[model samples]
Target: MSQAWLRQPERGSVGLLRFAAWLAHHAGRNATRLLLYPITVYYILTSPAGRGASRDYLARVLAEPPGWRQIFRHFFCFAQTILDRVLLLAGRTDGFELAVFDRDGLLERARRGQGCLLLGAHLGSFDMLRLLAVEQAGLKLKILMRPDHNQMITSLLAALNPAVAATLQPIAGPADMLRLRELLAAGYVVGLLADRATPEDRLVTVDFLGGQAALPATPIQLASRLGVPVFTCVGLYLGGRRYEAHFDLLAEQIVIPRSAAMDATRLWVERYAAQLARYLKLAPYNWFNFYLFWQA
Candidate 1:
């Protein structure tokens, strides 16, 4: 979880990813993406922890009939295929064809000389958002990421994409808080992935996907402290290298009511969780949470 780990080089994993990327690029879009379905299914079914979670969740989702669960699982796989095609095309086309939601409103709000929080999830390519921010919005976006265990993979992914590396600012400890505050003061948009809550982090419990789950309270707390607006941005993959970059103004204005920081944080987190649920329902497979989201 140290910042130094994120700087290491990938030894061989990059090669495999590059090959996969090439296949996704050269082969017929639908065909190549479809071929990946079995691979994903095989991994999900073969992995002990993953299979158990998938089975349990599938059962819960289709409690009415046993056959219904299998049918939906197959449909989910089909949807994943289409989503992969859209993602492949988005990368190949360099984001020109990506459909963006609330393009003007997001920018206008950002340009209003106030700090804003850009909250995203683990659903799709967040790096794509970095591209849009730098290329389209003319802004240097900074992301706060939880340090990954696989240092090599983290470094390689960052090094492979210069646009993403240039704007990504890795945060390790409380020491970086001042720097983050300064960035906000300077009107730089700060991006945070809010779906996962680790034991080491402060979290707020909320109902997500029809169950109770703990979500990171950092983003809302930071926004409240800075007295700024908070927005939720989602990149929905449409087929053929097109993405619908949707943005919702979660909190048009974050006000720290006198000594009520905790209450304000809870309110915003509830609103965010509700919106996230709606989007996940619209595109279930788009949710990339491999682990069980709701833990008691």
Candidate 2:
């Protein structure tokens, strides 16, 4: 909501990224992960804004104020997720362990050719969700996102897996909406991250992690407009190579009357924020929003 995150310049260059990707492919994940320590320390020493944001967030969720070591670990955790994205995109998930908890909901929906919305956050590895759902389970998924923020990384990752890149639906233009509708009608799951709000997004303040935070209302509004099933989903990293993909039905269909659209959207966003807080508490370091969250 601050829009400050959007202003933060991306770190690293195409060469560094290409090298990392090359190292991941050549040296293997375990060996490549040895590089995370120096990378984490470098970022910790250079990025004051991200470090301060981590400390502020930890103070709210953690029992005590976080120390420098904890902040370093936070950066390390983020680094791990990014590294895993490379392996996942490259179809090298044999070493990773994934525990999926969808019950009969999402799988049943997909089996019946009923597409739904998977509302996620920036808390963990979304690429893991894509790996399990699309690759393993054979579900069609379209990720709705704005890839222009980190164009360099986006382009590099797109190069790693062009198939995944093809599934990306940028959040722009009237034509995308029509395409999304067509995809959903054809039983393609559309995923969107609901946590970060841009300047143009409608903001809804909700109680989160002992403080009030502003989240975008657009995802809920979109669900309401589409009148489709909405599911709250997150892929949480549980240390090492373990991950948990959790999915719970948020709504069968969101209906907002024009009379009380504001109130209705607020309620939906509150529910969503509550779900996000629940998962974030489970893996605090998995949260990657490196900005003054509460201020926004």
- Maximum-lDDT candidate: 2
lDDT of each candidate versus the true structure: 0.60, 0.83
- Model 1 score (lDDT): 0.60
Task: Give lDDT tens digits, candidate 1, residues 212-233.
Answer: 7677787777777776668887
lDDT of 1 at 177: 76
**Which ten residues in a row are the worst by lDDT in model 2?**
11-20
Candidate 2 residue 97 C-alpha distance from true site, Å:
0.6
Candidate 1: where is the Cα deviation over 4 Å?
1-19, 25-31, 55-91, 94-97, 148-150, 256-261
Clashing pairs in 2: none
Clashes, model 1: 3
Candidate 2 lDDT, 96-197, residue by residue in tens: 899988736987898899989999888888889888754578788889987677567768878999988877888776677888788888998899999888
Report model 2's TM-score to 2 decimal places: 0.94
